[model samples]
Target chain A: MSTIVVFVEHAAGAPRRGSQEALGAASALGATVVAVLCGNGADAAAAQCGKFGAARAVVLDATAWSPDSAAIGVAALVRAEKASAFLASATSSGRDVAPRVAALLDCTLFSDCTALRKDGEKLVVTRPWLAGKLDATLRSSAPVLCATLRRNMFAVKETGGTAAVSKGPALGPGKAVLEKIEARAGGKLDVAEAPVVVSGGRGLKEAPNFALLEDLASAFGNAAVGASRAVVDAGWRPHSEQVGQTGKTVSPQLYIAVGISGAIQHLAGMKTSKVIVAINKDPEAPIFKLADYGIVGDAFEIVPALAQAVRKIKAQG
Target chain B: MKIIACIKRVPTTDLQPRVAADGKSLDAAGVQYMTSFYDEIAVEEAIKQKEKHGGEVTVLTIGSAEASKEVREALAKGADKGVILVDNAWGGRDPLATAKTLAGKITELGADLVLLGRVGTDRDNASVGPMLAALLGWACVTDVVGLELGDGKGTARREADAGTETYAFALPAVITCQKDLNEPRYAGLKGIMAAKKKPLEESPCPPATSQVEIEKLALPPARKAGRIVGEGAAAVPALIDALRNEAKIL
Candidate 1:
């Protein structure tokens, strides 16, 4: 059987949910899947890989947060297994790592895959291009293929494969040195990867008015707060909270825009979101044209009531 | 110092992209193009670095003859010169292949610095800059929102999932500009007319080979038409109900 490998994307002390999802997608191909986890104490992460149907889970002693180090480790794994396929979540970090892995193998790396399937000796990947405006089906025939999978596109399930775990080889120091990491704004949840995002804009009128969007995001519990470029430029919010062409690109599961005009720049950042909700008093606001749900009303009255309704619904459970 | 700003001419994304008659590539008829947003930022940043340190900025792109417009835009932004690798070989080339051509050009230029957009809107592959760096055996940083370069070293910052991260690298590094890294200045009439006379070089492109190929292209499933749940605070309960029962995301 051809061996397929999945890279483990880690967070605070553990692999993130997307890591399991990658493994699950690979397993659905009916091939023997090996999950590779690199970094300190990554062995613990391997323990759960078996539950997702991995044939084996291997740990490599690579430095954390270094794509180059992880790619080198994966290169080793590929050589050992002569792996036919590799997969990782298409997160910001994954985007940094997967290409180098492909380059190392002389294979082509495909990104933002919504569907992947194996056909005999080849694999096909479906991806959205130009902001989901179109879909392209890509085929790889390099004997080895590398791809980054989009989040929420696959389901994670327990196959109870019961894989054997072991330690693998590590790579040398990476070229770039990570000097520091600091929180610039918002909180732990980044708008780019958050499952839910609630954003505010100039319509809020003042910095304190942003608290309304915060309340709505708080109601989601897991959502992050975002800001329009106008608000960020006006000093109503930090640049880290800004979402637009010149800001962060996010494709969260749900995105709510409040008191914001939908400039194409801002829409470009979040238009790929699975669900979009827009609230603005201007009936002709361009945001409403793209919103999955829209309400034309003053945010002051509707946001508080919306927050209350969301809280009530969550409390019911 | 010599700086190479690798660039791409991507289609404006606000409108829908149509598949060609072959159903495997983008339709080119009447398609409008501009310098990819991030690459524009890279160009502006490269010019800024040149202003700070004595160096020349050379804008390079692997594209058709039409992409010279993108180069001219970079020239208007203050690049010293421009080169567009024009060849059918570049068509359908994967990120790795694109890196190969770029690395060749950068190497030929005896580069001391390289810059590019983190990702092109068309391919959305934020891979070329780092791939080029790896091929050249140089350090690299991607999605950079902040940067400072001088002497023989550079420092940069970017946002991460948890927070912001800072990195330091030496000269001959490849740095990919993220959006908001710097606001690209507009090309005024004088700058635009000056770009008309700036040297723009074109290189022949040969057929290329890659491990990846596109099989088909199709439109994504259209979003369902939305409905107004209600009006004002009175509609909040209905919206909540729709989210819980219909969308089931909450």
Candidate 2:
């Protein structure tokens, strides 16, 4: 029987949603799922992982081990347990760690996997390649398979199963240290985690003009601000704010593209958004083809009007 | 000072993609390819650093023969030389194995600084650089938007969740350029012509081993058609109602 290890990623005592998604994926494989918790709050993470259907939660309590250290430890655990597969959430931390673990274990790794299944004695994982343009099915030659599940690709359910929490031997000191974390101005929501997003492009014409996108996002109250690759390259916004094949891949509940002529690269990142709205003066813009709701008008004119309209509606409520 | 930049050639993301008949890879029949967006930034950063510090910039890529075009693109953008590691067997290898192969070649080059895009545009794994650093036993900083190098050490700013993190590391490190690191220069006609004369070497390495495999490939389920509740501000109430009740996101 193959055992699956899910690396639990957490910050400030709370586990990320992606961790639960990995747990969900691990469960579907019918493998014994174990959560590997590192850093300070291992106990809390272990408990949460248990609620999410991990059969066992292993706490590698080492103060010196940063998130990166977990990669080495995971490799050690995989060897020690003789686990057949390992799973992780495709977050920044997981992306950093899972590959190193795979390298150390001399195993294959499938990243940003959208689905998984059993193919005879081997596990087959499906993942997007070529910026969501192609889906690839991969099979591992090694008995141990590793994968990182994309966020929001799978539903995380509370299985309510009791997990056995155990403590693993400390892996010793790590090389890296977490010095400090500085919050961005106004503490905007993470683009990867936001439920809604409002993006702009070169069509916005100027930097200050992004206020229109801000207004729409403010109206949504839970939306993050994003930009097309062109806009970001033009220095209209921070690179972290860009949404596209090379930037952040977001699958929000609503993605509003203002003054944006949808480029294929731009569409690859947010095409999975649940509700797509495009506002562009060019009625023939490619964005219109993917938009569930499209408005053909000058973004400069339509944006302010839309903002005022949403403000009035919110005030009424 | 010596610098190395690893780049990749990826399809332009703007085109409609068709899956291969085997359902396990991109058809790549009619698609256009370009240097990945972040790789452009990586090459630009390398050039900028070379200009300021009087160093040499060597761009590296691991792919098939077609990858030479991307190397030529980077050479036109001011890289001093190019190295293309081509192996037919590495066509669909995972990121870890790719990193190992690249790291081996980079280790052979003995660069003082190594640079890469935060992630490939196609894979978007954002892992190879850091993983390479780990494998090479070098300090690694990823998602670097800004960088300043001096006297065998450097400081870099990287994006994180809801914030930014700045770190200082010694030379002989690997850093992945994020989108905002620097604006990449367009290849002028002169540069394009000059690139033909630049020295580019091609070498093949053993295919790195992969442990993770893809099982099946399919397009995500298509979204259902959405109905517009109304138009203008009048539509606001219905939008809110639908968000609260129908979508249940509110």
Candidate 3:
């Protein structure tokens, strides 16, 4: 079987959900899976990779978060194992380093792929082009197929197996060095990873009016607040929360667009959501055309009522 | 300081892209084209760096001769010159090949710093910048929202899903710009006239073998049409019922 190497990132001694999903994807390909990890708690995380179908795990002794250095270690591991494929999640750091690793290996990278499959001896991936407006299925002719899988798209398998764990190469000091990091306040959920997203647009009227969105998001408990390009450009919301072609493409289980008229750009971002709900004053808004359910009226009156209803349901359950 | 800004011409954001007859490419006919959104930021940042550090800013791109429009626009915004590595099939080439092509040009141009958008709005690969840095053996930081350049060194802050990460890197580095880094300035009429006379060079890109090929291209399936469950605040109950009982996702 061909060997596939997966780069795993972790938190609190466990693999991040996206990393687990990457391992799961590699294992599902019916290949020999080797996982490579770095940073503190990598050993603990490496030990748990077997459940996700990794046959072996290599922990690189890199404590610092340096993208170039990480790529070096991953490239070395790929060479050592003669891996035919490499996989990582499409997180910020993953996107940062995977391309460098591919360059080191003299290969091309497929970013934020939504699907992967084996075709005879070739690996094929499905990814969004034109900001999710077009889905392109691709095959890599490079020696190793390098790809970053989109989060929440693949399943995490439990094989009840154990991976043989070992140490890999030590990292060298890279030219770019990580200094310090400031975590987002309140440990707020990221819109891309949230189960439910409550997004607002100009209909909110002002920055402070987003309190209604926050209240609704709080009611959901796991929901994140998102914004349209207009709001983000107007400085009413952070760019991170913008959901559109130039922003994040989110596929949460539930997506709620309030006061958004559903520009084509905004629709491209959240159109893949499992269930969409749009609330706007304009009855003829384009967003309602794609929404699974819609409420027409003043967002000021509708949002508070929806929040109360959501809280009531949560309380009963 | 010598600065270079790499850009890509892409379909405008408002476009509803359609698949071509080949079933593996976009229907380019009648599609409006413009500089990728973040690339505008890249061009702006390059001019700013030149103003602060006193150097020439070269705007580089890989596209058809028609891309001169984008290059001239950058020049109008204070870029010193423009270079187009003319390639009609740039969209078909994978990130590595694109990086190698750029590395060849950047090596020839010689720069202290390079800027690119965090992600190309077209393919959304977000790879060429770091890949080019690796090919050139230089440091790279992606999704940079804030930056401060010093003599032969710099500090950058990048946005991440987890938090904001700060990095210290030396000169001769690649920094991929994120939105909010700066508000890109518009070119005035005088600058536009001046841009018409600025040096804009065009050459064929050195051929590199692409490792990826598109097997198929198609639009995602249309969402099933939905209904207005109810109207106003009174609709909340029915919406809740649908979510709890039907979607089972509440």
Candidate 4:
């Protein structure tokens, strides 16, 4: 019988949402889902994985697996278990680790898979190619198949079933060590993790004028700040903050684009957001067609008002 | 020092794309193509590194005949030469196949250092670089924003979700350039003319075996229309009420 191995990703002790999504997908894939936690004190991750429907949770106690050699340890676990399928989240860590694990197993992997199914005896994986412009179905010939699920693509569910927990022996001494981590300047939430994102474009006119976007985002409280390719190319904001086909692909619950005419490349990244709001003076802007809510007016006047209104509501609460 | 930079010619994602009737490929009727934005940065970084370390830069690409134009563009920008890995049979292969083909060519060329874009503009998979490194059994540093190379060793600063991570690796390593790594340069008229004379080599390789295949392609569903509350700061009151009572976000 083939078994499914879901690699658990966590920070400190809290589990990442993408990891839960991977477990959910694994459960649907018809294999006995096994969760593998590689770092020290992984009981929390194991429990969370069980709550999310893993049939069994395996904790591999290895300090070397702590941020630095996590990939090597994951490769080792995948090899030792002889897992037929290995699942990961498509975050930075997953992206870095999945390919290496696949290489170690001498197998092929599909990244950013949105869905999966069994086609006869082979597993057919569905993934967005060409910046989400094309959906491709992939089948692997190797005995071990690997995939990284996109964030928020699958819903997380709790099966309320008890999971069998097991402990595994450590691999060996790791080659890399965890050094210090330095944070970025922005205290705002990351664009990828934010439920709501308010982004600005060149239409905001100048750098300081971005205050309108800041005010609006602050009003939302849970929102993050983002920018278009043009604004970032013009050096109005850092490249890290850019969102487009070339930059970060985000699918926040709500995305508000300000003073922006949606270009195809720009739309590709955020079109998947649950609710879209476009604020632009041009009624015919491409953004209007995609927005769930659109206001055809000057952003300078609309944004400030929106901010104040949001503030008032929050204060009332 | 010798550097090999791998590039791809992708459709300029700025335009809307149409799916063919087969529902598995792009129509490609009027869409324009260009060197991927990240690959441009890779080429520029290679040129800058060559300028600093006194080495030769060779730009390599795997694509159809039209992709040679992108190689010429790289040569025009300052590369010493250009090489095209032409495989008509491998045009529609997956990322792993593409990486294997490129790795074979890179090995044949005897590259000391390999540079690639963090990810291509079209696919956004971010897999080929690491896969190539694994195939070659070479050290790799990905999403690099800063780099320093000397004495057959290198150090790189890579961007992560939490922060920057620094890594040190020996020579014959693979480094994927990110957007913040360097500013790409434009090809001047002189460089464009000089590019015509640069050595352009064409090599054909056998098609790589692919384990993944595409099933279908379709457009994303459209969002429903949303109602506007009012106008200006005065309208803010009603908007707040809507968000609280209607949307429940607040």
Candidate 5:
């Protein structure tokens, strides 16, 4: 059977959900699924991989490596894994590193794949574009195939695979350095990772209107607040919270877009969210075309109502 | 100093792209083309760098000769020259293949630095700069909003998972521009006239055979039509019900 390697990404001493999602995607490769990890909690991450689908796991302590250098360092370990197909979650770091791995391996790669399956000894992948209006099916002829998978596309289950753990050598000196990192949001509660996102737009009118969204997000508790490019440009929100062609592309379990008119740019960022609910006064709003549920109304009235309902539900449940 | 900027010719974001007669490709007849938005920022940054650092900025693109329109657009905004790389080998090629071709041209030109859009609007992924950097053995940064050039190094601030991070890179770096990096300038009448006088070069860049290929392209399945559960505050209860019971999200 072909050997598949899944890259496990970690943060603050635990495996990130995307890695588990990647591991879940790798399970269907039906190969000897090997998990590879680096950075702060490689050992812990490897152990976590065991519950997903890993048959074997390798660890490399990459404390000093930046995302750019990590690609080079982990690629060295991946070479030893002899992965016929390599998989990673399509996060910022994962997207940054996967192509470098492919370049190091002298093969081509795919990104943001929503699905992958074997086809007569080859693998075919599917990715979306045009704000999910177009889908592209792709194939690679390279001996080793590598892909960055879309978030939450594959579901993980406890498989009790009992992966055998191993250690890899540390990386030597590298050219690129991490330098300094300034985080806009505290606690790593990134909009990209949140299960639910409450996004606001120009329809919200002013910056204070965001407080209503903050209340709704607080009701969802685990949800993050996002902003469309227009509001962000208007200084209604920070760039970190912006979601559109120029901002973070998110795929959450549920996305509630308040007052977003659904420009192609805005839709391009969040169309992948599994369930979308748009609240807009305009019935012709393009967002409704992409939303799973539509509420035709003003945000000032609808959002407060949503907050009240969500608060009551949370209080009771 | 020699600098290269990679630009892409993409359909205007406002236009709705339709499948051509082939049913697998975007219709070309009425698709208005422009320099990919982020790439325009790259070109603008290159111009600012050239003005301050006494260097020439060469805008490079990989597409049909029709990309000349985008090249002139870049030149009008202040690039010194333009080069279009067209190849039958590169038709429908993926990012990795495109990067390899750009790497070859960058090496051939002996570029001191390279700039590209953080992500091209078409195909919309941000991998080309890093892949090309890997091929060239250079430091690479993406989503860069702040940049400062130095004697042999540069500093850049880019968006990260939670926030933005600042990085120091040695020379010969590949830095991709994000929005807000700079205000891309519009071409004035004089600038447009001068752009027509700028040297535009075109060459057939016979890229290596691509390993990855698109098999088919189709309209994504339409999102299901949704009912307007109710109007205002009264509808909020039904919405909550849908979220909690039907969608099971709550």
Candidate 6:
């Protein structure tokens, strides 16, 4: 079997959901899966990788947050294991490190791949091009197929297996070092990872009006507030919340677009969402064309009412 | 300080793409082209650094001669010069190959700092900047939103899933720009005329064999047409009912 090395990220002492999903994806292809972990608490995290489908785990002794340094460790692990493929979650840090690892191995790196499969002797990946407008299936001819897997796209399975854990390599010093981290306000969900996204546009009128969207998101309990490019460009919301071609592409279980006219750019970001709901005053809004369910009315009145209903539903539970 | 900003020419976001006859590439019909969105920020940052540190800003790209339009646009925005590593098959080159070519040019230029958009709008690989840095044996920070430089070193902040991460790196490093880093300035008529007088050099990129092969390219599946739940606030109950019962997403 071909050996597949997966770079697993962890929080505290447990593996992150996205990293487990990446491990699940690698094992599903019938490859010999090896998991690699680094940084603080990585030793404990390595022992847990087997439950997520990794057959073996290597713990790298590195405590600092330096992508280049981490890349050096991952590249060394790949060569040590003679892996045919390397995979990581397509998170901010994953994207930062995987490219350097690929470069070290003299291979091309594929970012944010949504699908992976083994075709005979080839490993094929499916990824979005041009900001989700085009889906391209690709095959690699490099020594190792390096890719970052998109979150929530793959399954996380538990096999009740135990991995043979061992110490691997130590990270080299990085020229660029992480000095500090300023965490976003605690308990707030990121739009990209949240299951539900409540996005607003110019129809909100002003910045303060976003409180209505926030209340709705709060009612959902698991939802994150997002923004259209119009609002983000106008400084009504941070660029981090913008959902469009030029912004982040979000694929949520439920995506609600309020006051958005559904520009091609905005639609491309959320159209892949499982369920789309649009609330707009304009009856002819383009967003309605893509919404699985749409409410044609003033968002000012409908959003508050929706929030109340959601709260009631949660209360009943 | 010597600064270089790398950019790519891509189709505007307004385009509704159609699959070409080859079924593996853009149709290239009526597609309008512009500098990739975040690259304007890269150019702006480069010029700002040049102004603050007294250096020459060089805009670089690897594409067909047509990419000169974007290079000249950067020059008009205060870059001292431009270089285009002419590659007719630029769009088809894999990310590592593209980074290798750019790394060669950056080394030859002996730049102190290099900036690039987090990802090219075309393939959206988001790999070239860090890959280039690795190939050149330099430090790299990706998706940078804020930055400050002094004493031959820089501090940058990037937005991550959990929070904002601050990184400190020395000179001769690579930084990939994100939006909100700065508002890119528009070129005035005088600036445009001056840009015509600026140097724009073009050279043939070394032929590189791509490691990744596109098997197929197609538009994403369209969402099924949907129904209007109801009008106004009265629609809330029905929407909730559908979410709970039909979609089971509540």
Model 5: per-residue lDDT, tens digit, A1-317?
Answer: 47888878876655678888888887877788888787656787787787888888887776665656777766776687777888888877787778887887887778888889889878999987654556778888886888888877778767876789888776555556667877765453578778899999989999998999988988888889999989988988877788876677788999999989988878877887888999998888988888888889888999998898888888998
Q: Compose the digit string of candidate 1's lDDT tens values, residues B141-247.
A: 88888988877888889766667789877887899987668888998888888998988989886556777778999876656777676677777777777777788
Candidate number that wins on lDDT, 3 or 5: 3
Off by over 4 Å in 3: none
The digit string of per-residue lDDT tens for model 4 on B104-217 reads: 888888877889999887767787887788778677777889888999888777777666777767788788899999999999999999999999898886777776666666
In model 4 chain B, which range of ten residues has the least summed lDDT? B228-237
- The sequence of per-residue lDDT tens digits that candidate 5 reaches over residues B89-179 is 4447777778989998898888878999988777776779888998888988878889988899888888767677787778889988988
DockQ of each: 0.62, 0.44, 0.86, 0.47, 0.65, 0.86
Each candidate's iRMS in angstroms? Answer: 2.1, 3.2, 1.0, 2.9, 1.8, 1.0
Model 2, position B145, has a per-residue lDDT of 79
Of the two candidates 4 and 6, the one with more favorable lDDT, higher being better, is 6
lDDT of 4 at A199: 92
Better of 1 and 6 by lDDT: 6
Candidate 4 Cα outliers beyond 4 Å, as residue runs: A39-44, A58-69, A117-122, A137-142, A160-179, A312-317, B225-230, B234-250
TM-score of each: 0.93, 0.88, 0.98, 0.91, 0.95, 0.98
* lDDT by residue (tens digit), candidate 2, B1-250: 8999999887776667777787666676998988887888899999999999998999998888888999998999899899988877655666777888988888788898899988887766677887787788676777887888899877777777758777666778788888778878898999999999999998887766665544556666665665544444445456556655776655
Give the per-residue lDDT of model 3 (tens digit) for B1-250. Answer: 9999999999998889889898988898889999999999999999898888898999999999999999999999999999999988777788899999999999999999999998888898999999999999999999999989988999999999888999999989999999979899999999999999999999998776788888999998889988888889999899888888987898
lDDT of 6 by residue, A17-99 (tens): 78999999999999999999987678788899999999999988876778888888899899988999999999888899999
Per-residue C-alpha lDDT of model 2 across residues A232-315, encoded as one tens digit per residue? 877889878888787788878788888788887788788877778777777778888887776666777666766666567668
The predictions' CA RMSDs to the true structure, in order, are 2.5, 3.3, 1.2, 2.8, 2.0, 1.2
Comparing 1 and 5 by TM-score, which wins? Answer: 5
Question: In model 6, which runs have C-alpha deviations exceeding 4 angstroms?
Answer: none
Better of 2 and 5 by TM-score: 5
Q: All models: lDDT?
A: 0.81, 0.78, 0.92, 0.79, 0.82, 0.91
TM-score of chain B of 5: 0.94
lDDT for position A205 in model 5: 90
